[model samples]
Target chain A: MSPIASNDGMRPWRLLRAALCVFVAVCLLSPLVVVLIISFSSAPFLQFPPPGLSLRWYMLLFSTPAWMNSLLVSVELLVPSSILATIMGTAAAYALVRGRVPGAPFIMACLMLPIVVPGMITAAALFGVYRGLGLNGTLTGLIIGHTVLNLPYVVATVASALRVQDARLELAAATLGAPPWATFRRITLPLVLPAVLSSLLIAMILSFDELIVSLFVSSARVRPVAVQMWSNLMGDFDPTIAAIASVCFLFAFLVLLADLALRAGRSLRLT
Target chain B: MRPIDRRIWLLLPATLLLTVAFLGPVGWLLARAFTFPQPGFQNFELLWQRPVYLRVMGNTLLISAIVTPIVVLLGFPVAHMMAHGSARLRRWLVFLVLVPFWTSLLVRSFATAILLQRHGVINSFLIGFGFIDEPLPLLYNLTGLLAGCVQVLLPFVIFPLYSAMARIDPALMKAAATLGAPPLRAFVRVYLPLTLPGVMTGATLVFISTLGYYIIPALLGGARQQMVAQLIQDQIATFGNWGVAGALSLVLLLATGVLLALLQLTVGLKEIAR
Candidate 1:
């Protein structure tokens, strides 16, 4: 809250800023908007001037067994991987923050290194090792890969939340005849709960959108949506790809929206 | 320190999982690339002599160098504007930057293909406007690949730089201005130097990600412009050339490590993106 609101109007610089902002936003949103419209198209093919609108394309998506199976697989992988990644990340953050573990900085770096390294390289490297160990084409392998990639985000987000925490709050609880477990259960965990939720949602998104690693490590058994989309693209640029993509967009939006709502509610509780 | 707390013991599971899942894969692959059965420098030597391999490496570096600096140069003005703009306006700009953030890179690349192809919206628009007799070479080439890469990497550079720029206090700039330094000079002497850490971060993020990308080149670039990642991918998936694939993989891994380490230790992007 600045005292000065800067509420003046009709400035040249402001107009220029508006134009640039509008252009970037339009560029970002228009592709998905176009794709969403075409998903409801009546044309037999991915025709640009789509003949008409209907839910037939979506119905077609639902009817296909392979598409249905892939969607199910994506959900199965996302939920478990997100949960596991969150747990591991929170535990690691707690350990590193609370204890003077030797080589803590280096350990933190190693835990979050996948975020910096290119996914393609990581995918290739993982493919070789899994194939060597006979872990390729299994749901177990997909979970392992997805968890590794998502863990870093969880660590970073939860760490930030934990770092902002007040130590005296825990000390205050301890002074009030509270046991260590009670203090942690009643105070420490609650403070970082929103961050935990945020990390989990982000993990789910990462696992959902992942394509390159799935392409390498997975086969027919556990194909994620992104992997299935690649086969559809290469097989002949199937228009159902767009239909499914729209479904995915909506799906991701809802999940993120839900997370934001949860965050707002949680903060209300804290206040 | 106070013998490990019970809560702190939770770290073992995470450490063990990372060891098996992440570091295990990476370390094992690097080692396997060298000594699956026996060790030798022969695998790496081939990486140097193969013309295609050399050309692809050059292409990788060239693309990274070209695309990153250009994005930095262009992104600075926009990020700077956002930093000083009204709060409401800044929020809208951030949303604009992040809308594509939610979408997968695969989806964005596909859209870029549709937008830039010969019969795509862009070429068709220009041809329809009588700018050229023929549809200009827009898609399935070097130029198209560059265009898509720029769009993808722009946000990565912008976010970090914008974060840094937005943190600069306005009072410092006002002081410089009041001391008879023109606005341009004040920005050049004060703001520019202060934001070098951000510039370094943006450049590292862009350069590293660009070096390891395969999709943009595979979809948009012609055969003449194949990058190192594409070459390695083709070796394994297309040709099933295991020995060459291993060699190429090692070459890429070592090259990126050495380059990134050099950049990290010397130029110091640690304070920025890391």
Candidate 2:
């Protein structure tokens, strides 16, 4: 690393850089910090330095059926959707990476369309199709929508992991009389298990957090927590919204920790 | 003829899922712009004829243009520090950035709302400090919308910019200095151009993302701040106007495609995949 500049003329620039860094940090973090604090506020409305700390909002969140049901719906939707995405995505990543498929890059780009395209377009399209199929407002519809939305992430992660592994290991297993399925199960699967598991967690978090598509496909009866949060934000200015937001924040924190633990000893890539 | 590769079967499941659920539906929806309500270009015509539709489209582009530079400006220094700072500092900055990145956009927008609302944390703090006599109208306006978008998109720029900066050779800067160029001049003349690929990618991403935003504008913005995505939703939900919704979706998709093409020309889409 380069040494820090020591010239007196450079001191002013260094100080300015430090100040900007602090400003960016505060901008990035203060909103979440404020929400966490207000979630525990005893006041009926959103108040800062909150009148006093209390669990009433959290209690109300648990006690209210709308919030509880949406939470349940989010769990149900993410579980099946994430599992399906992981299975399909892992298979696709493996095929393209090791199967020597022609036009792999083209296929990969097609798979990533869900992510690159505007979520609004995806949501509108699904909402239109589901209208004819009688799938809108159903749990199955939410699952399908989320699976498609989350497929690219899983494929990207697992494919990157597969690229870095030694393809010769699989060839060796095959030459040693291990059948293809057996070789995959014993060798490739074990090696990339962490990435597969990490992608699974990532898929779950994405499905849980997805909003626009859920807003279109979900109804009042089958709303996810994100949809419920949207409705709450539009209608109310209460701390219960903060409480639920904090709950979502907690879920994200746990997932991040699990991901770190799963991928320990490996360097993290920001992309 | 050579037998087809058996491993191609592995791709069948995902391909089928995407074809049936994603491509087929989205394709059919966009096609409805022509076929719906008697197979004419009336939907596109309607969009062109109405002043409000055009205004919303223009407004969406304008907001995105405004948001791109702000995110890049705010993101540049943080990315710079991360690229050049000590290891411990880098770790801390990464954690700070990732925490917000991983958090749900819904939650972050809500948190931002709480902070920007009248009598919210910011206003309360400012008033307590005797900076203002009355609470400022920070929420439900352009200011509120900008705050929400800038905070959410900072990571989009920072990560790309950091990757670019990390790849830059330190000797280039040193060489410029040895030539008697000052630090600011070197940064402007030698350092900036090398980071252009990252800047372009980040700016394109921010611009396109802001164009498609729905939730942030709906929650934090006033009626005057309606964006194209919100307009598309209104067409479907409020009016059940499928033809117009399809037309608007076509426009939005084309804009995204054009930007991606531009990025591919300048930096290669493969760089983004990396």
Candidate 3:
């Protein structure tokens, strides 16, 4: 393709475009960087160009019983919810792609409803329903809500992976005297394992980061870290909040590195 | 009887879970908008008669309207650079965008508060450089709300626009130049129209997302900047008013649905999946 002819007259427009891109990039990244820096500050309150840096805030975060309990609750919630979502979502995706299920598109859309609807609406609805069933303010309620919210991600990712793989391999194994389960275990699962693992990590992150649904269903004793952060934000501007936020950022960074390593040479697609 | 596809059994677990835990609850809540505390239209009437409810709804719409264009304008250049830039630049841009996208909303909002508070980094820098005598009231106001929103929602617009721009044929631009069209004129006429699908899809996503925001407004916004989502939460938590909460939810869902329908009509929803 012939490049748009570069000339002296186009210099100003090019400069303006480049500047705008740089500004947007800084705006996108600066908040996270600032948080990372302030998490190390020794000051009790938020301060810029911090006088001295120390790990006091992080130490406080770990020592506080409230923060520790919320951390435990978040782990307890995300583990079961993410595992359940991944398993069910993988099966559904495989069935839609290969099983020739009737009305697959409609089913897919139905499954995506939790995400398409606003989180606040879902939270209120779940709260109202749980009131009758006496599931409100319980760990089980939070886990169930997070699973529904995260299911769509797993389904979307695995479905894309399955669509890209060669279905003929499974068919070939079947024709070679292998049963359906054997062909699936030997051929299909190995090929899509990376995608399955990636989606599991994504589901876990989504659950850990979830706030609205957890806020509605969880009690003081069953709160996630995000809800805890919200309550802390409502009261004060302590640097301890910044410390916990940095811990969250670090968790996300590690997950990103793992995801990139898992799909090394493949083009990244965020679902 | 004909044998059914055994593979269809795989769909059972997910379907059962969604139907029982998700659809049943959300559907029951929406149904309460009309039927709760005795079946009648009183809830909708209450929303109409009370000026506060109507005003908050109006404010939510106004905030979303303001956010939509700013996100699109800021997102356009970054998306363009990513679509046409060198491989190294594209990779860096993608990394920058995804890192924030994956980070928790709580973390980002907290970070934004740190940077925008009166004695925070930005204000300190301005004062240290002798730009102003008094610190600006940046946090807990409209400016703070907009900053929080535009940062989080930038990726929503950028990715869709990048996908649209990458599909454009460069030859068309060369032809427009050869035919004596100026660069600006060529972009306005030939390029912008082609990117309409992407722009519309991204703008719609941002608008709907802004309408449902609870965390950002709670943290960064002042009393005057209250949105509908917070109102819904307050009703349920403070008053134990499921009827009013359900009614507010209905209004929010209707706004989202109407916009989604319009987007589907203009550009199929599949473009968003792309």
Candidate 4:
């Protein structure tokens, strides 16, 4: 570690490095930024550099029936499904990490099965599972499907964080007359809160952008924005889609940014 | 807590979740694939009945094999550059690597369509450069599909390698150099072997992901270029054959699971992720 120095405090080198970092970050984030730029373009066609910017496209989004319906569908599913996934995923994370479970690693792998499993399979599998239960094309089915898909994030990330946590802390509290529930509520909950919040944010973004599963299982009730965008992209290149994508991109971006900000705030508070 | 009591009781829910929600469904899906469309291995019949299905599967495997190597080739240098760079620079590079990650997959696919369309940017640029008389056939074809998928999947391979290369001990490289190995040789012999786990991780990650990628192929692939995922989709949605759809889905699931198990055996997850 000592082998490296901060450029021996070389100001010019430091400045160059800072510039390089900024350039790289911009390049990496360019796609999202480009979408944002194109989304606000006032023209009726997609172009790199816009002649002018207006809220007309966004206005189009609000006034249009199809666009509004898709947005509504996205929200309706994301809100409740995120909640369910958080609870179930968090419980599963706790069991996998803290519990004296047999074959913890295998369980962790199973929890992460969705991420590793192709979405096509999950789509197909759910098509089978959801149909057998009479939940296919219904909100309940979509919830079950989304929950299973997004649960991996909450479990994997939170469990990794929990694995580093001290087991003795809760035991100490218990010895001092704190009840099991109180110990969890006071200590474990707060510590894992950051992971939980970020997980929720990421999961919501995932369910919102998810296309394959929705393509299979969903119908008019929850035909998400992604489906609309996919259809438009396939059949025709509509400028309104660019606009809708821009808004969806912005909405998802804010959620992720807020998640990062939230994590930062927690670390700051802790420090 | 007693070991057996705590372990068994606590794991009860996890086991049930795995068995019922994940594995049970996945296994049932695979069984459906074999016995689908009136039972007795009719789904596997696609392997022989439809050469197009086999061709598509081959195309899927071939494209991934192509993409994986290129991803590794391109990703390694980038990862190396970021790993050895100053922390300030590396952090920014990392942020750059992650930026496309947060964007919508569908949006990227659309952007790819716009980029690769016959009269789109690439053709426009080539025409401007006076490279060709006419626009090249790009999007809605295999060339465009591969291009779009590689762009999205590049990050998967890169991120894992970046993390792995970052944690590597610089001293080992220095040690190799001290023993008279040149920097390039030292990197090839010393660094590359250590990073094999990352390579495997990245490859498996991309292979498994590219296997199920729907948006990229749907938005970019031509009529003849559709992958298994799309085939399954069409079978279920357009053709209205749940049994066939169920069957094909199982094929992909089993293929992916077997590959994943192979990855674990080859790379050993503990070394890379942990």
What is the C-alpha lDDT profile of model 4 across B52-158, one tens digit per residue?
77887777777777767766765665676688878896776665676577778888777767666776666877988999989999988888787777767767877
- My TM-score estimates for the predictions, one after another, are 0.91, 0.97, 0.97, 0.89
- The C-alpha lDDT values of all candidates are 0.77, 0.91, 0.91, 0.75
Interface C-alpha root-mean-square deviation of candidate 1? 3.4
Residue B75 lDDT, candidate 1, scale 0-100: 73
Chain A TM-score vs. truth, each candidate: 0.91, 0.95, 0.96, 0.86
Docking class of 1: acceptable
Clashing pairs for model 2 are none
Instruction: Give the runs in model 1 whose Cα sits over 4 Å from its true position.
Output: A1-23, A175-177, A259-271, B239-247, B254-270
Worst 10 residues of 3 chain B by lDDT: B1-10
lDDT of 2 by residue, A209-235 (tens): 999999999999999999998887778
Cα lDDT of model 3 by residue, A1-271, tens digit:
3445465556787798899999998888899998888889988888877779999999999999999999999999999999999999999999988887878999998998888899999999999999989999998899889989999999998998898888999989999999999998999998888899999999999999999999899998888999999899889888898899999999998998898777863444323
Q: Against the hidden true structure, what lDDT does model 3 obtain?
A: 0.91
DockQ, structure candidate 4? 0.39
B198-219 in candidate 1: lDDT tens per residue?
A: 7877887788888888888877
Alpha-carbon RMSD of each model: 3.4, 2.0, 2.1, 4.2
Best by lDDT, which number? Answer: 2
Comparing 2 and 3 by DockQ, which wins? 3
Candidate ranking under DockQ, highest first, comes to 3, 2, 1, 4
The runs of at least 3 residues in candidate 3 whose Cα sits more than 4 Å from the true structure, single-residue gaps closed, are A1-4, A265-271, B1-4
Q: Give the docking tier of candidate 3.
A: medium
Error of 2 at A167 (Å): 1.4
Model 3 residue B237 distance off true place after TM-score fit, in angstroms: 0.5
